[model samples]
Target: MESPHAVLLVVLIATFAICNLVQAEDQEGFISLDCGLPPNEVSPYIEPITGLRFSSDSSFIQSGIIGKVDKSFETLKSYMTLRYFPDGKRNCYNLIVKQGTTYMIRATALYGNYDGHNNSPKFDLYIGANFWTTLDTGKSITGVGEEITYIPRSNSLDVCLVKTDTTTPFLSLLELRPLDKDTYLTTSGSLKNFRRYYLSNSESIIAYPEDVKDRIWESRFESEWKQISTTLKPNNSIGGYFVPQNALMTAAIPANESAPFSLTEELDSPTDELYVYLHFSEVQSLKANESREFDMLWGGEVVYDAFSPEYLNITTIQTNTPVTCKDGKCNLELRRTKNSTLPPLLNAIEFYTVIKFPQLETNETDVVAIKDIKATYELNRITWQGDPCVPQKFRWVGLDCNSLDTLTLPRITSLNLSSTGLKGNIAAGIQNLTHLEKLDLSNNNLTGGIPEFLANMKSLSFINLSKNNLNGSIPQALLKREKDGLKLSVDEKTRCFPGSCVTTTKKKFPVMIVALVSSAVVVIVVVLVLIFVFKKKKPSNLEALPPSSNTPCENVTSTSISDTSIETKRKRFSYSEVLEMTKNLQRPLGEGGFGVVYHGDINGSSQQVAVKLLSQSSTQGYKEFKAEVNSSSNFC
Candidate 1:
């Protein structure tokens, strides 16, 4: 047997090694993000003063807005906002994370009536296309947030803002903090829900250097509770428990020593079951027999009857409390013991509701097929990175996936490759997308017999292969399917006859030259004859019309000419008349990326006209306008 001194030395060395290893891992895996912090800018991969890299939502979402919150409140004046997603789909913020590591992710939504509409918005939050929670800023203009602990299966995590019908979804803040291994364990491999409150009577919103983890510790409202501060502060960390490092730096004691301090929260529904945690630490040491004791009551039930206070050491009590929000309220109270001299005090409190997270994984077969197709055509128009269909918010560009509620695996429903400049045979990998409903391969250089395997795709309802150089007869299966409601568009000029693949033949050059010469001789003879007739009927005595015409023609002055055909009826309007009809070009309907579009009402008709004023500096605007005019004339 080893000596006691040797054993003690060995144990000490082992403990020191373990601590060093843990510290190294924490530094390597920890990540933090402060979303929408600096205003009036779009940043991608910007490292702020906090040393954590974050990106704005502008790069991921195309349409929406970003701005600062109302500055009337001092605590939240520095925060920013991202809102107004009219499309009901999800807009995601992709964060790079280590695979198979547990992370605590939190999102804060502070409406503060940012739009000045004085209305709060409610919407669902998502994690990599899976439903996480619903953020409802019910009545409080302060802030509302949700926190969850999850282990990401992939290297990237997609946090999405999902819009609802009644209101647009938005996000104000987001933070991701990696946790120590074996900290929050789940037997069933599911996510844990947590709510953290920074209980302080002082008006300090603690974060960053104060909290270190960058967790938002909301300060208590002084009006709701009277303040009590301890002169002798306790150690910052709690023992053996996962309490925040700086949570106990400040503490609060109730004002009235005789009455219990209580807190009540309003839940969205009455069916919420929660797990509660209360953290406590003694600020001042008791002299001799001076003691402070308390009993905790949750919803009229006594949970802890004789809870004694401890100094320097931290104590945490946990309970599984199933609470139904009667009148949408759940109450908790902390009362002093009958024999105690001091009032009850609390450092922090948390409530976590139990929920099952969705298991989002892409279908394996669809993944293989889509990846192969991407490789075959070298389709680089859109970035084809990551999984093809797992996260609905970050699906492969130019593709649509089926929305499955109960089922997590997604199916490819549509493939739009129109005008993608793809030049090759229709890839056989497409056969693997069994659920494909529509396929567009128009306006490409694809030259080959139409693949017959397409007819086997039962759900295909639409196919476009026009403006291609394909020269094979249409497969009978496709033709038959077209008759049964599958809309098909194939160019007639390149289509060949069935059974022999007989292509249209071109005329010889000699025959074309002979026909061109004869046409030119006939055109010369007609021109000579017209000239001779014009000379014989020359009006030598005819006088030209007067340069100035005072005679009025229906009191209408032609000021502008329409760009339409000469034979078409043209109506002219003077500059003043145009201004009168447009109301001096005021009241714009909407503004696009290039110009502002105005709404105008014309006189003598019930029609409303839209006038778009192109920006003078727009170089491409003139080209687009001319092309549009030519196309319209040809169509008419």
Candidate 2:
């Protein structure tokens, strides 16, 4: 018999243990990146959303390609600002994480028909250099997501998206949540990626401090079983497991002994071995003689036979035996054992498959350098994603790389920027590419004399600086290199002269003076001839002339009209002509304060004119009519 004091001490010790466990799990960090989120936005998740810190891609190079997703997917619409890689280049998101800690990373991509072309892309996902998963978003717009459990050897992890030929790559969401060390134990020193499905008779999503790891446990229910609801709420800790309380809070059991309760799930994994866990909790407190037993079967094979569950406490039974999947499908079931008094019940289930990753890619330093170079010069026309030199066929535009395989780091051997419209001084950052053998900056607007650093580049065997605007004497080191078999090309246009590099202006000064004098004399004679011709062509009745510079070509002046012969000058009428010309204002043109302007034919001629009927009530209209009459008197 246990003493009251000993029982109290045991409860206190258990309480302390649970507290410590909760604290450790809570200390884990959660980073959620909304990929294309608006820069500097600080929206925190709440309620239906997880309490995650949301961030944007402001730290990364601003990709010109961005798009919004449909509002129907509210969970993702908030993260619609997607950074798309139209150039089909590999883009990576570097996250600083705790070293030697396990983390669950999830990335989601949604086409949203964002480009309006409805072209879904296929790409490879990478963690550090290791291949993580393939992102093949077939034809669905629902968005594709891949989750992986990884332990970062370093303080950071690089989540990369590799573009393929089929479509452009893009990212919508990136979530990283640190997990408890003992959550998913494995023997191969490799972590197994688990997919959790929540089974319940209720409508609710369970996550976060309840799950501690914040895993999304999808809910499910059956019509045959009686739903047992528990008032027990999930606290921060659940014994030694970090699974959510909601996962183990609800259960469904059969009503009678004659009927058997079973849960069968078809896991969509063909040809691969699987690991499954069934979470159970006896929701009802049974009588002293009452016993509930069940048998769990993996494709008709009894893995756990005649297992009895304890009351009000969780008992998780996992399949130690790998279920061989046929045709990419494996079925698992939990049924009541024979002679058992109670029906079978389940709270949640977790499934996982082991994946064999391919060999990691080349060294990261060289890869990052090339990416920076492309970014610096805005060279986006070429799809430069993934390993630059691995696989050989696709190695960025105008760059020659030397590498043995995916295991070997590639070196940039040659660069061809000739006729690439590269302007200004040659980017000094090219110094980072120390392995270069040939450099061509020809036919560009590159200025500022040849950099002496080029001579220090011992690997360079050939260099072309032709047709550029470079000036000043070539560096002595470069000249020495030129003498020592270094192929150099600098045309006369780019090479500097012996003395100043600047042309002398003394010889051109006299020629310039003579040209100016000739120009001034020509201008004076032309102006006098124009004035004489204009005076002879002018008509005596000409009054006001429109300013030639300020007026449009359509605003013909009185002098230009009068310059015609007297016979060509038609008779002009005054204010009274408005009433006669418009035929009693029958033909409407447009409205104004001065009544309406009407399109009218001249009373005695075929000529047409626009006449305005001045409103009698408007003083401004009367003044405008008088001005129109005075203007008509000026015509020849």
Candidate 3:
């Protein structure tokens, strides 16, 4: 017979060994068993039961048919309408997968008619929960099938089966099992600590007295000391994951040249890399050819420090890794191995790096500048009595550019001056502008003859002279060669001359004079010639006439009464001669209803000569004026 105590000891030892073997298997066997051989490539997935689903695991029931599911085991479910067409994939569900883990999923259909129905449609299996995409691998099955060893992300994943039915279908269930993404030998280690290091990252950065700069500088070093201290705090740093025994650091200063700066204490080697913490302090870009202090350690104790005389540049953090630990916290710290535990005082070591950047300079630019911007136009608001156009801001509302593209003049070629209270004729000085295009002065209180000088503008295009108080025949010479190339448009009250659109009768008299004189001049000339030809010769009427006589036209007599006409002939002279006269049209002695008197030099003597243009272009002006001049006649 065996001893009872001895048998118990043997059983206990065997149980412990078995437990270890199972743990090793768990670590190694957690990968999908898919070899990609047709039927061997199994799909891994499980579906939620009793809901509207488009997966192969779901089936639809008609009014009289009831859904049947055998809950051989307990499950998670909710009752709802089951409506999903397989072809359209309406009401499909999703599966989540961990980033770096493996899993196996399988599904099979237990098809039986709830109301003694016919055969249901087929189903397709898919494994992935990408809402934007669908998985390519799965089986089309009418019967039950088994699949194994699917993969999950590093954490968890989902698998699904889609009902290939043209109509909606209900599902029983889909099964999923975590699997290994890669093959590995069985081994043993504490997952708590391994996971921490695997999850953490290592980084360090230097600041320029600014939080933004501090954040940017904290990306260079990696070490275990930082990972533990950063718990329960905000860590958006890139290297915020798990870290090991290694450490890497760098130093730098701000760009201010005149700023008085200080240095950081020498790095203390506790266990090789003892006081390793990231800070947003000064930053320096070290050169690759420089030197830095590097220490080494083993078994939680410092061995040696590899320090060079030349300060070094830190391209990467260099330190011993894979430090032993039991948990993710401060399990196996490699702090300054045997040195004093006091924290480093910044004022002690006085060692750091610095550089200076030059200040920026600027220069002046030459461009057209704006100042005291101002503009004016007519505003026809009856409510506001004063001229509203002068200051455009306080004006009639609609008297502006139709689109109001800007506060300035209209950029287009058109202008509208309709219904404005303009009381005066267009001034002659207005024609000084050469670029005036289209003009509208309709519905205004203006009265004047259109300026004949307007006909001299060659760029005149479209014009409207309608509904104004103007009364004048269209001047025939406006289109005539002597008048220029422009045309005029007019009706009862409106007139357009050159580029100007006259709005009233104020310009009508001058317009009529031009029309009559230019259009009827030739006819009058014929009548005058006939009169001169028919004149009879007088015998002896010559006698000594008084020096200053008032009679001149009385001397020459026209014979035929029917051929008499009082038509004026126009004379053209050099423009330079007119400029010389009246001392270049300046300083007129007097201007009146008849003509003008100017101080002029006649034979080197300053004389007050009255020069008459006689309505500018009168038919009888030349002869009468000359006769009066030659006879020294002064009705005065």
Candidate 4:
């Protein structure tokens, strides 16, 4: 070791030489850390490339790959099969490192297994639980080991080796530490669906999904940096963003000063800046007589020059600055920009942004769209909106759609459009939905008789015509099914005969099958008689009409049609007739997921019961209670 006096003199000479050489460059302190005097000591059994080795309190480490081996600097004899296992290619290393320093830990090992039985091992580098990354061992006989990086956010992180296959050689080591940092930035973007992916060393190998609200980026160098930056372009779908720590978290700068990275760091809004502490090696291959200083550039322009040709503090180097000098180290910090209008680029020299974006607009049902299916009520005001509808947004409280099939003409079986602070007559267009089984428009300022078209919907099992200015006679067909206990104050049963029938809670199963069967049998007999009478007078060759005629219609006109007109007409039941048949009663079939279904007799039809409900309690209960009542869960 040189004496203190001698070392002081050497430092002064180096500093003076550095100052004179960097006259045209940015004047800043430069430094570097070195591996003990060995040109190339191959860790044939371990990771490649050294990284930013700066120390910090909140340690965040990423890893890198092993670089190509140099013949002269190679220490192959020293490379022993530290943990040789030929079957599964499984190997482990116990890396001893200091704590409270942010590190990017990357390991690159050559794969030697080629048999079909060869499988990748699972390996992890840990510094307690706070720092660790797991890599899936792979089969790569090409000698380029699978590159994976990890950034441990905690303090007790450590590294662990995994061997997935117990058959092939455990794990082989070839190249080591090819990169300098332990984070990922996909220039073309990340592996889709992966929550987090990192690359060992310099290559941006990590890609984290923006699905989460907060995101973290780790430093790339083995040495700490003075500042760091992450930039993101604006995108509603890109996601909201965040960074882990500020510069106050650790040491001011990295040990390496060879070169550095840049990041966007300004926001019109109140945003924080990143302060990184990076570390890298600044090597200078010089001849014994060569003593010239060299200038260092990051992106382009020179930051500082080194007389001894080594690393410098390039942290303050402006964007595009040159990291020109050889045999020197570098570590720098860049800032991130939020919500910029610029085009999005993952590797635009320097840019990174992780977002947590939210979804907007959920409810947008229109009433004017359905005009044919009129209800026995006035159609009125539903709030208007221009935004597109999404599921969890847009304040659509009580509009539930059929679940079985979400697409197709939506089955609007239920609706609770009450007290939306809305004003108007119930929309007549609602009856256009023939599938509507329930309707609740109570406690609103609606006037006029309920639309008659509502009765046309064969699926309507429940009705709520209460607390409105409705004056027309209640449609007896709507009363066929009793729902919630209703007020007997209104005469909802047969008004054509002036209270001709009092509807009862007792259920009734239809016997209409007898009439249908009898009618079919009668029609068959009548048709046979009429055909025989007409055929008696026809010629035997009457079957020939036209060659291309689709239907076998008789050529007989008005004169021949009148002979059997009565028999041709089947017994047709009018709308009023079906209503009269429900005068009889039966028993309850019990309630289902939707409502109470009953076994009722409509004229002679049997086993034709209905799902019935009178009124929803929640509408008058809560403004949004109506949507829940229309639970698509029953069918969807």
Candidate 5:
């Protein structure tokens, strides 16, 4: 027979190996990002404590600077570094997830005085376009984390960090764990985690390898409570909640075995709604005549009239409807029933606050189209980090969305890429904007003929393709649309009708040669005339002429053209007038290489305007600025 100690060691080793195999197979849809970890650093490593794989966040976001935390808190690799956003008002991580799949999204932040400034920062966190919560990294090096159970409307989810105060917004870790679709269902909106704890006498935290879902359950024990635990593992094959057996193995009962087990929580506000989940198991063996029965109460109201924990089996109790503590306090008590001979006990508890997401995301097709366009052109606009529409104030620059109907998803109505330094052929993705009304591609280096898809877009009423090096025949469909009231603008010299394109180019070649020959003959005649005049007229006669008359004709013509240009120059607004128009530059539209654009209204009128404020540090010269202004004026 094997020794007892040796048998115990063999069992432990087998269990450890099994847990490792389970974790390796279960992480299919898990996404764990270690923010600010450099691309060249080691990544995709399994964290020993949680058994979850973590990778650098460089691929998920485009903005923010990386910094290492203070050396004192460098024990955990995930907490050693962070990503801090100091430029844009909002920076986001674009996470790709299965559409309609429920997920537990978690974001962690730690301020270990990374900037050498001891000040802790407070900022707002957002899920897609809706506000999730405000995170305050208080004066401790200990980190803070927020988790939410959500189902994204589309395949992509945006986790945004918004700068709400003077302090910068930073993130240490971001994780996504896919949950069963039927689990954690809410009537409407997402659920934000408030507290998740396992009743225990130990100080160690329990997560993955024990929980299977990688949920962090902190130990909680009150001096007034008596802890009861069993070495036997509880059967946790209940619902999809996945309450770990280790958590259910321990139970908390009142120190006085006959007293009711109770817990009280104070609500942040009277209107705050909450969902509570209670997990229980009979960890202690009972005598033949002993029985344990209880009635669960919330705020003095009985929720469950009679409840009993099956021996060594998981029993989960959750609120069917959201509960509100009107008086600002919630009291949960499990009172022993009249027939019960044992005390009421609890194994674990979880609390979540109901968070309503009323704002709808942008139309999926338009979002896909715009993001494709951004990729096609490699647009690096600072303000293009989140959703293209919804949350009206933060819409992407150069995009006008139609969100008049609250029930309908927002659609991109106008896109202004005028003088934005776009290159290559016109993007085909623009055709996906089904509701697009106006498009401005003027003053770009786009070199392709207009795509036929544009003619098929019935909603497109205006198109400006001027000042490009395009040489092609206009499609008949487009010409028809133009005749039927489409406002089309193109460089007429470079384009022609279907049959006339080749003939037109052929005619232009000879016409250009004839014009050059005529110019040469004119120059010869002028030279001969000047020589004859010089020979016939005396030097004194030439000197008698006015200085202005002696000037070359080319100089006079150039002067006349310059005067005409000055006369036709657009009106310029003063700094104070711009401020008044833009209401002190409060509504930002977007930022580009030139500067930031502000969405404003013309003073005393309902007309909307976009004011491009030049950055003081821009390296572009006056010529580019003038071209941008000219493009805008022509579009208007």
Candidate 6:
């Protein structure tokens, strides 16, 4: 039995746990990352202002140097630390989300002189492979935030920081918030947030629990405008936008009731297209006899005629088509109608610039196949961070993609993983790259029989599997394909019937013995020929003969002979001695027209050597053989 005080404590603890769980559930689709936060630090740090949880960005990105801002400028937890990329031209964060889901992505940067260099850095930002914008972190400790509302084409999203000049690229925070797909509609392109303002007299920035999406709504107040407020919460449940009720509680109206409420905005460029959203909620409770109605005009042209705001209910007006400002200026006015007796009021407003993404993403099948291959091989190449192709300049290494048609998605055509230290059988994912024309997996330790699927890849015309430990007969399908003009390269010695295949290590003994005996016989024959030639050309008066008149063999026997002495004195080894030198022909470096070359060490020393054994079917006769021996001897 528990005491009353203990029972009460248990209940309180359970209640607190439930509250925390509920808060976490509210952020189901939200992803908040605190860049450069130490991996060992406590994650899911609940930000005090927004009550949103933030985790370390170590899992999102692979390249970056963790840095800390000057302590004096550390205002928030997210601002204290940052990830800076000084190595690569582009560093990206890979995020996974539901395909086709609408999302609001926000990235923040603050240059707090982390490197002790008071100079700030300027760099470019990219969403996937398309350029988003250029960010300039000013000299001050103040932070800059950029936001975009987008619908991801696939389940993956890449937010990249690209270095444009000599300055390094860094990021302080990255956040993703899922939104209702119908909320931010556009005719063609994504929406980049320009401004989101709530008409209010307060100086506080509103976000989070107040605005469920955690969109930062800054307060905007004009001295000449009359402020209207109500304690009653506006009805926001009717619309998908869900404009914060607190934001809708306050309204701004013209000081002079008869004059129209007007505002003007400056565009970034003359050709900039814009989308405007205006939120209105009547803060005043009027009698049935009185009404508030206004005509909304854009650049002196009526856009919405005689619109009336329902008292205490949020009404949002959005542009159906993109509005282009003239001379880089846009103007809007809300005027009272003849039937209305009140001044026009505005509660909140949002401005967005339409950003068209011209570059198409890689084909879904290719992307999936490449991603699977990367995972299977556990490749960690830095350049493989984002889309394999697109943006042209940052294409993945060893990959050739076909992106000639701008309207169609890019497809992978070639993959070269030669000498990349790959193991195991060829990746099954490679067959899915239907457009791949060539694949080079040579100079690796890969084993197992060649996959028959390679033959099904109709586009494949070149394949290299040389210098590997593979065994078993080549797939008949692949052999047929090879006969059909496919350029295939494989070690013929390693090929055997399927069931008769043996490990290379077991088969190497017989080959090594044969190579050893053949090499010794060649050396003895060369030596015998040199001795016989010297006997046949025996010079009777050796002391009286001129230096140039002496036979080549006479120069070899002389100790004073500089170049030839080293070659003539080169030690000869027996078959067993050669085996000991080459580790019984264990490791093959590569093959050549003459024979196979085996890697060897000299006299148990670190000095490396390449031991070439002449093939039985080599076309070279005695002259070529002698020339080869002389050349090798000269090299030694």
A best-first ranking of the candidates according to their lDDT comes to 6, 5, 2, 1, 3, 4
1-636: candidate 3 lDDT, tens digit per residue: 111101121232332332332211222222221111122222332112211112222221111122542333122221111122333332222343454443434433333332234445454433332111121212221223333333332232333334444534433334344433332101211011000011123322121112221111112212211221221222223332111111112222212312212221222222211212222211223365532233333334554444221112112122222232122222111122222221111000101111111111010010000000001223322222211121233232322212232233322223355566555665443343344455566676656676665566544564555557665544544546234434345564444455455546757778987875773454235324423432332221111122222434233243221243212211111223333444554555664442344443322222233333323334454345345433432221
- Report the lDDT tens digits of candidate 5 across residue range 504-612: 4665888998975774465345334433543465111011011122222211122221122212223334345555666766788888766567776653434466666
Clashes of 2: 5
Error of 5 at 398 (Å): 0.6
List pairs with backbone clashes in candidate 1. Answer: none
Please give the CA lDDT of all the candidate structures: 0.60, 0.61, 0.30, 0.29, 0.78, 0.79
Candidate 6 lDDT for residue 553? 25
TM-score of predicted model 4? 0.21
Name the candidate, 3 or 6, with the larger TM-score value. Answer: 6
TM-score of each: 0.52, 0.54, 0.17, 0.21, 0.76, 0.76
Error of 4 at 547 (Å): 98
Can you rank all candidates by TM-score, best first? 6, 5, 2, 1, 4, 3
lDDT of 1 by residue, 266-366 (tens): 65456766666677877666787777888888787887887876885578777643445567578888888877887787887766655555655566587
Number of backbone collisions per candidate: 0, 5, 86, 168, 0, 0
If both were scored by TM-score, which would come out higher, candidate 3 or candidate 4?
A: 4
User: lDDT tens string, model 6, 260-368?
Assistant: 9987878768889999999988899998899999999998999999999998998889998899888979998999999999999999999999999889989878988
Candidate 2 has a TM-score of 0.54
User: Model 4 off-target regions past 4 Å?
Assistant: 1-413, 417-424, 429-436, 443-445, 456-459, 472-636
